[model samples]
Target: MTPKEYLEIVHIINELKDTPRHCVTKNNRIESVAEHSWRIAMMALLLEDTFSDVDIDKVMRMCVIHDLGECFTGDIPVFLKTDDDRRQEAKLLDEFLDTLPEQLSHNMRALYQEMEACQSREAKIFKALDKLEAVIQHNEAPISSWEEHEYDLQRHYAFDVVAFSSWLSELREEILQETEYKIQQEQ
Candidate 1:
């Protein structure tokens, strides 16, 4: 890779590392997007029972590289991302993937495309796990830490829960219930 490209990659990784996530954990730690992706991939593996028809490997791959485009676009909180912004973000993702080796780019692009469609069982399940994890993290955090994610959930993500499997959807609903309980407990 050229020095410029190498620097671009490095810069991207560093920015992701520094990006703060909306939810906090039981340990009072904020999760980064990178960590969130890793965790969700594991969630897919462990919860494969919920996604019978989908390829687990592909689902995992999709989850793993799903947010890589965010390395360039920065972390757009789920709530603040407008429909136009999401379309632009998708374009940005494609452009960045094109920078990779052909095979790698092709695979990542396919994975991202699958994620976007969310038509497959795996895609739906993956989306559910992704949001569920965030809600879980937010629930575990102190009450004061719930603004960006909660706002996003109410504004943009309110109807997204039904897009996933029943299991995943239930998990998401449970997360919200848990978060509310936690907030009440904290108060």
Candidate 2:
């Protein structure tokens, strides 16, 4: 890709840094889509040792790019996101990807498809990390930021997503403990 093409792609992706997500930070600031993506990528990096049988590098790449769809549609919380929201984001993301150089676009398009399918080990791990990261972030945020439904969500969400791997399942259990502790403290 030419420098201009690379820069253009970067320019497009830069929107994610500014896009607000549903989650709030501990400091009471709204979280950005870029921040969430970076944390999930880091989660993949730190868990690489446990996933030696899987392609850690590919998993990390998926973590980073999985939310590129949100750059165009902004972030719709998983709970609030509807089928039409998914369709719109997918369409806009495809349009954005079309602007990239062929190889990069093709590779990311394939990765997104794999992520959606969650059949591959790399895809499964990336998907688990994405879910786990949000749960983890919810624990970090003040209890006051949570909606009534979020109490149940934080406790129960992502258990199924992480169940594909024993290690990830254990991690989800740990988050469940944190959620219980947070709720008890709130009471």
Candidate 3:
């Protein structure tokens, strides 16, 4: 990569350095998007053992790249998206991806679309863990920033998370349960 390309990537990473996720660690501290991405990738690798039908590499790649667009769009919470807002976000993500070299841009756009489509097993697992990580982070963090976004339990249930939606649909419950358990242990 040229210095210019490297600097752009660095700038994106820097922009996200302070952006907090919906979850806090067990110690009640905020985690950055970079940390969240790293954990999600780890989750994809760990869950690969159970998802025999999924392409683990593809799933991991999807998880790692899923939020790259957020580097530009910022972390727009799922519940906050109106129809027009979503359409604009989609356009922004595509346009941002297009800024890359031809092949790289194509690949990133395709991956983003595949993730949104969630038609494949890999996409399914990635989406599931994405929610899971957010809830987990919220539990560990000091603030209920996620709740402030109005992403209540019902909305989460209504959201379509593709392949594992039926099975992993209780992300809201999982987050609350895990948070409760952690709080109890601390006491």
Best by TM-score: 2
Residue 98 lDDT, candidate 3, scale 0-100 = 64
lDDT for model 3 comes to 0.68
Off by over 4 Å in 2: none
Per-model TM-score on C-alpha atoms? 0.79, 0.98, 0.74
lDDT string, candidate 2, 81-109, tens digits: 99999999999998988888898889999
In the predicted model 2, the residue pairs found to clash are none
Cα RMSDs, all models: 3.6, 0.8, 4.0
Show how many residue pairs clash in every candidate, following the order shown.
Answer: 1, 0, 7
Which residue pairs in candidate 1 collide? 79-152
Please give the distance, in angstroms, between residue 99's alpha carbon in candidate 3 and its true position after superposition. Answer: 1.5
Q: Give stretches of model 3 more than 4 Å off.
A: 1-3, 142-187
Which 10-residue window in model 1 sums to the lowest lDDT? 150-159
Task: State each model's CA lDDT, in order.
Answer: 0.70, 0.91, 0.68
Of the two candidates 1 and 3, the one with more favorable lDDT, higher being better, is 1
Instruction: Kindly indicate the candidate among 1 and 2 with the higher lDDT.
Output: 2
